[model samples]
Target: MKYKKTILATTILSALLILIALGVSLVVSPMVERKAEQLLTRYAARVGAIERCSFSRVEFSPLSRSLTLHDVLVIYRSPKGLRKSMDRLEISVPLRAAACAVPSLRPYVLPENGSMDVCNSITADGVSFSMPGLLAGSLKHAAISGVSADARHVRAILDGRRPEPVDLLEHAVIDGLDAVNLRATVQTGTGSAACTLGAFRLRGLHDLGIEEIRFEQLNAATNKERAGIALFGMDGFRAPDAATLRLLLSVRLDGKKSPQALDKDIEHVLPMLQQWLTATIPPVRVLAVEKASFRGSRPQDVMSLDLMRLDWLSNRPREMKTAVKDLVLPAQLVESNGLHLPGLKELRFNGESDTRDEDGRIRETGYLSLARFGQLRYNASYAVPGGVFNFSLMQLLSMTIHDAAFSFVDQGALAYIALNQHDPDMAGPYFNQALDYSFPGRDNDALRAALKVFTDRPGTLDIVKTTSEPTPLLRCFDVATLGRLWRVSATPGKESLYDQMRRLAPAR
Candidate 1:
């Protein structure tokens, strides 16, 4: 009987202790919530210079060291006023400080006693920002993971609807943000379009592996015009200088100006652009694109490009190369302009230029080749006394031409052009007669021979300037005639462009 009584008494005492614990929880939770709210209000008031901030509710968990806010809003009034709001914001701070204390020494020592995660997570849901004449952006959800100061992981889904139908990112994951891929939808006046940014890696301000940037209309039937970049990439990217960045940002962010005033505003910025070009500009190693295309509703509106590339191989002596291949233009469009030549497939261009200081003169040498149904190659060199070039017309005219040569290879285009003329059968003889009558000199005879050879049987013909003296560009065009200055010489070329470039840039 005594043991049973003792057990009952002990049970009553346990029930009383449970009641006390419940009372403490109810009282402490409200107090913690109020304190969190007060702290947030104080912070907002203290740093409310650029923006006014407020929240409707605050929830805090002391054990987990996590805090959540509901109905957070911020209003900014710079250049033009804008508003931002979020449905909920949650931040989970680490329960222990050891993990974040020495973030740089990661993957070695972890938080003691497994007290906290390696990263503190902060999340925002239903975030939206809007400004007139600019953009309206929203985030369905976004999260930052890893150390709070330096996040190692981030993920988000962002959408934009102003300026264009820009659905910025359907989903994105930035693992240390080393590499990222983004896809978006762009709304056009005619129809909707989709854009994709291929995988790219980032280190500090440098970027690499920018595999592609593509755009294409979603519904071609409903669109009046369609355009796309099938592939695009660049290497050796350096971020612009701080001042340039600030200038660019100010122009975009200062939204006080109206659309009508934009052109004038840009005009005022051109002088500053000159400084931008010469200051803190680093060369991009390589930029390439494959298969950029465009099409309009009309059949004559089609255009396609197979490849385009630019290389800044060297900056010391300023060596550069550029190429354009298989650029197609609609034959119908050409015919509409009253040209009779048909069956033209594509146009191509390859060029290389080098500038260097030799002795006391600045020498520039380059070769340009253009090909459509036929091919034409021009190689030239110019020299000028070592001095700053002010880019004036007089300065350009004063430069001396050291050497120049032009070459042509027939690929059936000459025959088509001759056949389309009146009196096709006698076209060759007539052209020869005209050449003789128009030019009468020793150099003229050489040109005549080259032309006759080409007419007899379509073949390669070369013309080179014999002038060894430095001739000013103005005198070359105005005083000296081409027939008197240049001579025809036979130099055959059958090498493909790929082989030609390989020879030109042996280091590559």
Candidate 2:
């Protein structure tokens, strides 16, 4: 009888306990829901939106004292005239945090001990984005993996109806203390327009610091009529092995715009662009080093001239074909800068056109060859009506040597100009000044003397005798010119000519 009574009492106690637990759950369930709603409202207030949110189910566990949520979405609209459409986003966070900050659920708080996952898909008129996995944890850090976007038929309305398309792929891994390391690639193309930026890496995201970044390849191709300017191929730009103190930019213009028209626009808008870019883009200020190298390969017969290399360090780098026709500029003064260069160190040109031979026979054969380095530093400034002006300076110092304290004091001052007034004939005087400076005469002895500093071993320049009719490869300033000026001989025992040339070249 005693055993029976004890068993019966135990059964009753167990049933009562079960009922009590069920009652507590019933009461807490509504509280949890209310808490979630309140939390969402608070978040909406902070972000300044309420109608842009929707939520699914929220569940709590008593055993672990944790909360889990599903299907949380947030949508936003971008400002007018932007490229994108609606910015649709979705994220899932731990219910604990979501509940603790609720305004309606008074004195009820959930502990923070869980993780969150976010996935978003945004689509604009021409742009589309999808991120597969974005995760955050209390103990661990946040990360985004397998993120991709497709941007086709996109247009930047700010600069007229410019057609733009962009495709991006990115992935990132972060640590507990908010250290992020990421890699991404972006490619854009529209019509004949194309651009690619590959092999990008970023570290220390909060402050926008890049430990190492490389542009493995960059290329653009566009028809002349569409591009608005002469097209140049900027093949591959590599940074020095060490970290750079300054910023470098490689921009490509590939659209249906004439080079002259583009130049005019650029001339008018470059300052504004510079100001906006410097102010809006955080990365620009951190970059202290800058270098731009270019290459171009045009179809034969398109023009009368041949392609040439642009050697930044040469005394007279090869000249690029400008749209200006019949300008009557000196051959030596090919560029805006007063200094005549030897030629570009690297270049390749091929094509043929009628020279109007006396017999007037058409010739189809053409030849191509590499170009040599020429001019070093070139600078020129021109102004148009309405206070519009354009000026540029090319520094020939090598990236390696320039970073080692090449002085820009002289050139820097020249680059600074305040064109508050209009001057249309500025190009003429600048052109004339370049011609006068580049004339081959004793008048430029100071420049010649300065150039001599670049040649350490000036005597090695050998003038080999030609047995056959020597074909003119291309017109370039040779070390022989420097040697002649130094009155040095090509004798076998003479000081190393290369060393002398280096000595004659000006130090940065």
Candidate 3:
């Protein structure tokens, strides 16, 4: 009877001890969780200026010093209003250095801990950011790891959104370009903000990378609106450097898609975004923006424009033009659409085109430059009053000559030859063999009435000081040719010079 009583007492004592231990553990866990969340919120608010950070479930193990949170929602104040959400966040602190968990990385103080496990987030389901009514960006199944506790540096594998292009033109069409496996690192200091993006490929485009992008700062606030930097802009541009900016970067995104639908509100607001930003944001300047393997209306009609990449600089509205006024090019631009431009050098644009209106007032003056092709260098301009390519220059033989010749000639040689009953003109039999042309009324000169357009000696122009008036296209010829049928029409005393030539020609 004594042995039975002792055994029973011992059993009851053991059970009571176990229950007490469990009660204590359960009671302390909530306190630890609260402390961990408070620390997280305090540090995060310092780094990102987080307004509110809420998590549905917070778990902490005091013994192990490990913390985890689920369904995290973070709000930040900057360029307009910004919001970020993540699925799970986990942080581990070594027991030896719990005090140094936040900032002042004493990685050396704790040799075992070279870097503090400040943040290890897993958006296993998805991640998202938004600006109230304006726009939203999303990425799925990404683990953005290794964020410094100080929040000055971080890396992410972002397979997600690039800024949606603002196409104000109605009935606008677009191509698909979704990125994948984008490995990017962002680091910011007092002077500038820099990013390195690589190992990324745009669907149907080349593998792209950004070697360097150093921005002056991301201006999140300018006092005009209670918004963030997205509202203000970046230092992507500087007015003093409108002519040129010394920067280097490489990125490509060419997607092929048919315009499936259009949201009228989105279309309207998209362009306003650029305009509204121009009024506030700092200029985000870049050295270049190039595209390759871009398809257009027809799949086979791959856009192989010589200066498409640089056109973005010159084509933007005047206020936004200075942002990237001079877009430099790489040595070679390539794409998957069987289109390639090798040995391309630079685009020295003046941000204007010569396309004139019906009144003949000089309109936009665009595309004037000294660019290289193969071993040859050339200058091309679409500066004509009507935006037609009025001039082209390159090497012809040894001398640097320009065949400023493009013809929609009038009363073509055949019609004139037939009208004259095969009468020999200034060109004689060669005139019959010359180009058959038409469009006779553009020229009003009576002396050279047979040929509406004539050639000239290609001379260079000062792009800055060049005249801005609607002018006729010059059809220049190799001046050194003894039997050259082309004449310099604009020369002083050109009529007299032509008269002598007419007298020497075989009688009509």
Best by lDDT: 1
**Model 2's lDDT to the true fold?**
0.30
Instruction: Please list the Cα RMSD from the true structure of every candidate, rounded to 1 decimal place.
Output: 13.4, 21.1, 21.1
Q: For candidate 3, which ten residues in a row score worst on lDDT?
A: 242-251
**1-508: candidate 1 lDDT, tens digit per residue:** 9999999999999999878877876776678678768756765565434367888888866556577899999877664567788899987766443223334543444422312243466777777776664445555665655432112221110111121111111112222222223334445555555444443333222121122222222122224666667666665544344444445455753677887676665665554554433233334556787877888888667788778887755433434567777777776665667755545543444555555445434555555554544677776766644343333466677788877777777655555555456344466577778767766666467666766666656668787778867787776654226667677765433542223323333333
Q: How many residue pairs clash in each candidate?
A: 1, 74, 31
lDDT of 3 at 311: 16
**Per-residue lDDT over 237-326 for candidate 2, one digit per residue giving the tens place of the 0 to 100 score:** 222211121111222267676788667666655654433322322222122112222233432212222233321211011112222121
Once model 1 is optimally superposed onto the true structure by TM-score, how far is the C-alpha of residue 412 displaced, in angstroms? 3.6
Model 2 Cα shift for residue 117 (angstroms): 16
Rank candidates, TM-score, best first: 1, 3, 2
RMSD of 1: 13.4
Answer with 1 or 3, whichever has the higher lDDT. Answer: 1
Residue 390 alpha-carbon offset, candidate 2, angstroms: 25
